[model samples]
Target: MKSEVALLQYSDASLKPPLSPLFIHNDPSSNIEDHPSLSNLNITQQQEQVQQFLKDDWLPITESRNGNAYYAAFHILNSNIGFQLLMLPPAFLTLGWAWASVCLLSAFVWQLYTIFLLVKLHESVPGIRHSRYLFLAITAFGKRLGKVATLFPVIYLSGGTCVMLIITGGGTMKLLFNTLCENKFNAHSLSGAQWFLVFTCVAILIAQLPNLNSMAAISFIGAVTAISYCTLFWTLSVKKGKASGLSYTTSLSKDHSAVAKITDILNAIGTIVLAFRGHNVLLEIQGTLPSNLKETSKETMRRGVTISYILIAMCIFPLAIIGFWAYGNQIHGGLLTAFPLFHRHQITKFSMGAIYVLIIIHCLSSYQVYAMLVFDNLEIKYTSIKNKRCPRLMRTCFRVLFGGLTLFIAVTFPFLPSLSTLLGGMTLVPITYAYPCFMWLAINKPCAKGVVWWFNFALGCLGLLLAALLVVAAVRTLAITGLKANFFKP
Candidate 1:
């Protein structure tokens, strides 16, 4: 590759002439000897050497090849928007959700910092392979600490898959059971034998999900739906306020009346934290983009982050305050249930249906990405004959299993809130707060001078504290309540 690069540069005459002028025309033998024009070429070569040295030494090497910017941007938007959807409803309601969001957002900021740090660290160490810097901690601690250390990645991958399956099967079933069966209590009342069959099918199906790239491409359309839904909320809120000829207080959820101010604060804090989980998607996005267009990757991520925050702040804050005040705490997942109250008198039922369908699709796309990431982490691969990537029999079996499994969960255990809470508390919390801080510490980045480093140190400490708190909360909830939740005080 290096030789090819040099050859490509040599081909550019505009860049520099390789042959000396004295050796031109008839004297071929003179070409083998040093000529006066060769001195100029020598000078150019020296300058080029200096420039190359600086570029190679000081900068992170970007790929020479480039691809379409639009496609790259679309890729980023798709994955990130899924994180955004995963964040929204949780951000408006749950206490822990706010913490989760903050952890995620912090992780995103840290990811950007890590890229810069990795480059700076690489530049600081001379004559070192980039992989040495990249994986030194992994090699030192991971390879040498014991056979136990080798299990971390395997554990992470396996745990990830399990979390994904649990959430999808649980969330989908919850949505289906509530929407179709209209059963509130005893939602998962299947017999023991029936439960066994249900889980077996779900396990097989979730084990055979798609890759990150495919999910990102498909999610772009769903993100547009999310944007539209936000628009619908804003337009309808104002119209409803005008029609009622009442104050903003009237539009708030009424069930929240009996709740204490501290609970509201806690809930808001949790919601804010959960809203920040958009960071995790950025890591995968950064790697996926063509390495040649480094600047565009940064800009694409920045735009996505900025847009996500602005959209959520505008759409969710008022929605939460209004939904909680008007309907009270009875609002089940803000996007699904809370919207109708704000525009109950204005939009037709058909319009509501359109919004519902859009939300479901958006949710499914986001859920699929989460599941895919989890499965991929597990090193699970499934092939499709349409792409001739996997064997035909396996692909057919995989699809049939997944579909049947989803349907089983849909029929048996349809409880979205509990599933989200459990999954968010267990997997999302650790992935966001615990892992980033641990990874940072693992890298052993020497603390720099002054207040900036101290601030980061403090932030890392806070993340650890929050992570510990979440673990305790999750454990307590599981012990006392089992898997069932009573989010409503009643």
Candidate 2:
């Protein structure tokens, strides 16, 4: 614990967070290498010496992090958008177009600011890098509390995300086959379970491609498919023109009364929040870049974030507007499922099938991005307990187990995706919206009652309030809907 404290930079004694070692000092502008204590060493020696201070060299994210800005941007794009965009249109209708647009843009801007906070704080400790959320959490809170607080959310998020992807990807693949071969292949059609197995098989293969940074090609494909499908969905909807009749009303379970509408709106905020999924993995994304005082990884991270989110905005804003205009409260699910694909006058079956292909591909890469944190945790735990490095065979087995477990859960509980959305309302909000603000205050405690201190305090409180409201709304929804799901229905 003392050695770990020695490795990291610290805040002033007056503002230090509750880490194990109580030593504290103000963080200087330059990195540890530039600190006077280490100025005697040669440049190469200093760089290598700084490397000696990182606590978790055994972690997977720390292995061969040779990725550049473009790769980081690609992974960010892959993580941020997916089938979640499909649900955003409904949020628009529920919030009403004007209010919905405001919420959507506001969430985007808010998340963007929070992610920047995470990036800046990644190397707040000079020679050390937070690299992973667990490390960052521990730095902000102390070891025991941080470890307990962070591990569950990260585990559930990674596992739940992978499961939902399998469900959605497999279902999308099944849809494509049904669309393309409606008149044919009836005698030998694969069931939804088989399609899920197929998706899992492909994901397992992608998972074998070593470290997170090494999967740049796969991430690139995921980013492209996400953008492409989003474009196709919105463009096709706009081509269909507005519905014959429309009203400014929202529907959930076909109920649009005052009470139901309010509940529906609360749930819709969850939907929008989940769409911007980058925060769950942003620190790890930064882990793949090189950081030093000369050219910090935050610069690369911010650039990539700017580029990726600009593209995300272009895809999502138009989609939300057009999707709401076309279907209004009538949209029951995704834009693609609002009506039969083959029967649509403006959309050909071929294009619809292509969109499904993109969805499968995007989900495949998304699984890898989210699952990396779980993989790192598993590997690190093994190394810690055994007091030795995790071998290749054991690492391979970990990937297999992760892929298999998510596959089993996804296949057996197709309805988990719906439930998971509500769960995400409770679980994801703190991690995404609240944690960074609290962390910033703890690590860089500005003058009390000063602008920086009060601003962060207010935002943190706001985030907590929003999370509490979402949790209450989710509970009300579950109480109303009841947990009715058939086993192995998919």
Candidate 3:
């Protein structure tokens, strides 16, 4: 018993976590020869020995921080997918799913190609480092084709601003109408209020008159208005008719399988390619970031592509599935219509609003880029003529003129969607995809390259095929829509 007690005491005193001694003695008077194991060494010596053992055997700990980065990345990805789901109708998900997948793949490849070209363009220009010039080139090219690039910004801004106004305006009118119905205010009844709203719209349009650049502004506005109405044609696909939950279902026609398939291809391609339509802005992002941040931003771009493309696929897939299952061929903007049911909360609303704002800003910024390019090109032309930057007064005058033109479109038609479609589908398509592949082809000869070279060649060919398809689709859509009255209708 005494020996056991002594051993227990010895062990309690000598041992410690992480680096514990072998043993210790409780009794100070115990002879060293009495217990060879316990009396051989003091607690200090045992601890030292234990620590040495640990030091020899222990491996370095490696704590990874990339987990959180990956989490954030996936979160962005899911959100993008959610947006795509909201856009896609369910019908295509069932029958036209295959075609949609093809479009998305094509869109992704095109996006990569487009960005590459923009980078190449940057390298091509010597010492001229303004991004806005790219936008100018688009405008210049479009103008040669009889489309006004500078005039586009005005139209896009007007459509968004006016649509928002109408939404707000309709709400205000509804409130007033309800008040009149209840005899709560002196304002007239529903019909009277309706007339008042029409008059108000007219009055607003008239006030915006002096700012008009031409019929171009009005035409753009009307087109957007038409698109807005068409947008409402798509039905919401909330389960139990609930307004907030997962948007996996859609309301689309079960018929018109072939038409839906074709539409799905076009829509999927449009969203994936157009959603990431800020390669111009990427240059700015890269330029502004610090070296480390820039590298991080490059990673961010990769993450973004993966995230957005995946999200687009997720959203569209389920939508195409459910849309076809339910409403079939009648699926319009099946993705967005479903939003009201799934996104009733303020946070969701705010997030969606922010996305819309980002898209709008992206579109508007694109116009600014075009305008700056035009100004730069014009300045060079002016320099050639008179050997100086265009006079400040003249510059200011042009800015005001352009700014006013934008305002006019903002108020007048405020409804055009055709301009963006044409730009994105035809010119932007080739410039972004075809040019990059060719540039890479020119820069990297195939014989010197093995896998990478052939991969690039394949990518270029894919881009060319997509661009050709875009041109054909765009022309076909335009022709079918008719050119007799005003062919620019959305």
All candidates in order of TM-score, best leading = 2, 1, 3
| Candidate 2 deviant stretches above 4 angstroms | 1-58, 248-258, 339-345
TM-score of each: 0.55, 0.87, 0.45
| Best candidate, TM-score | 2
lDDT winner between candidates 2 and 3: 2
Question: What tens digits encode model 1's per-residue C-alpha lDDT throughout 1-490?
Answer: 1101111122112311111001001112223123332334676774443333222121111111122334334433433433223334333344433443464465456534543333333212222222221133332245344224323433332333333444443443444434444455565655333433454454444334344444444556656765666556545654554323322222224555443333443334344444434334334433333321113244544454455545545554554444333433344555455556546556676676666555545545454443443333222222111211344455446455544554444444434334443345444444444444444444445566446555556655665555455545544545655764332110
Ranking by lDDT: 2, 1, 3
Q: Model 3 off-target regions past 4 Å?
A: 1-102, 113-272, 280-331, 334-386, 389-392, 405-416, 419-422, 444-451, 481-490
lDDT of every model, 2 decimals: 0.40, 0.76, 0.37
lDDT tens per residue, model 2, 74-105? 99999888787888887876677778888888
Candidate 3 lDDT over residue span 253-276, tens digit each: 556476554554453465445443
In model 1, what is the error at residue 42, expressed in angstroms?
Answer: 33
Better of 1 and 3 by TM-score: 1
Where is model 1 poorest over a 10-residue stretch in terms of lDDT? Answer: 17-26
